[model samples]
Target: MSPTTRVLNASTKALYRLCLLLPLLANHEASAEPLVIELHIPDAPPLTFVNDPRGHGIVGDVAVAAMTRAGYTVKIHVLPWARAQKHVSEEHDHLITPLSRIPTREDRFTWIASIMPMERAFFSLERRVSSFAQAKETYRKIGVGLGSAQEDILRSEGFSDEQIYPLAIGDNPAQMLLMGRIDAWFNGVPESRYIWPKVSKRKLLMSSVGSNADLYLACSKQCSPEMVEHLRDAVEALRADGTVKRVHDLYLPQ
Candidate 1:
């Protein structure tokens, strides 16, 4: 072969290799960048507290730890319970924390792992009922979180619209109960107990277990499987290492 032709052939081969190498380099750069994940939570106490400096709340603290362990940057959004749920449901790769895993929500999102167990009950200042049936007949206006799993549970159990006073997730239920706006407050037991003391020094009576569920760290239906697996593994590790319980204890009274 002529020297010029040989030089051109070598140059052509070098350029072709460079073309193949460029994409790999680009992919490496992309992979090296930390993935940013959105974490949404309600202003529910013991689960999340909007702007609590002490790591947000129990589930919030655990979520941050898990996300950090999964090698991702988490951006937390404190939204109303209903709005947060709707947005997470519509968006891709978004996460909602402390979401109760119920039959109605089984297909709405991808359940990553259980963050905590949810045992719901009714709390009253003056009224007490032995069973749901009795409570339904006894209480005229029961307070519940707006668009929460508790509301869904009540509706499913035949609670009429007029009977349920849906309040935004917060300490308002305790205040409402004290003000005589709601005859009873139906919510997660931990949340109720946590708020009752903050709002009033008075004691409240709790009814029998109203609903049972597991609160989960869930992603949107269109979430990335790789991300899901990373978070799932991180959360499982935290649970196994006693980190979850440790975080939970921080919010509960000693």
Candidate 2:
């Protein structure tokens, strides 16, 4: 080829390299800005907590597994429900795990496919709250995860405004009840048992309060729809292969 033509081609190739490398450098700069996810991990009966790798919490384990499948790295940050809720609403690209897609939040964000149906209940000092009817009279002076869907249900059920109390994410609310802070703390069936051993030495009053909600993987209002679709596809594959239930059973309160 002629020298002029060769020089022009070489310059074009160099320009292409500069363009590609610029994005790569920009991505490197963006590395410090992580995609933050928020969730409330309460300290209940059998459920537990640990850092990444050990993954002791049931929902945490399931979430890590799903994140692995989705090919996205996630940092598990635990905080009180109020704070988590605030950040999830205000931040960009933030996410909340195990949030029930209630009517109010239906239009809030694009949702990833559900991870599992959260089976919930009430656990007291000694008696089992097997049904909502049974709990109607007995669940006075109750402690529960604040801003939880359970709290929403109870509020709708005419549980006195003063009767429902919010517990810290990692604090033992049942123990608080046993200590007389409240009468009982609502529990998620398997998650409570999963976390029980960590908080209490003995099995307390465990009952299904007849409340259940389909939990979903929810992204913040600003998250891209494409990201949600990819996560949904990843979750579908996990369900197809039965990994989802296996993860749940392994960590479920039994």
Which candidate ranks first by TM-score, i.e. highest? 1
Model 2 misplaced regions, further than 4 Å? 1-53, 201-203
lDDT of each: 0.89, 0.68
lDDT (0-100) at residue 45 of candidate 2?
A: 24
Per-residue lDDT of candidate 2, residues 165-247 (tens digit): 87764455656866877877775666565555666686577776467677777777787776677778877888899877776
By lDDT, the best candidate is: 1
The TM-score between candidate 2 and the true structure equals 0.76
Q: Give per-model CA RMSD.
A: 2.8, 4.5
TM-score of each: 0.90, 0.76
* Residue 148 in model 1: lDDT: 90
Q: Where is model 1 more than 4 Å wrong at Cα?
A: 1-26
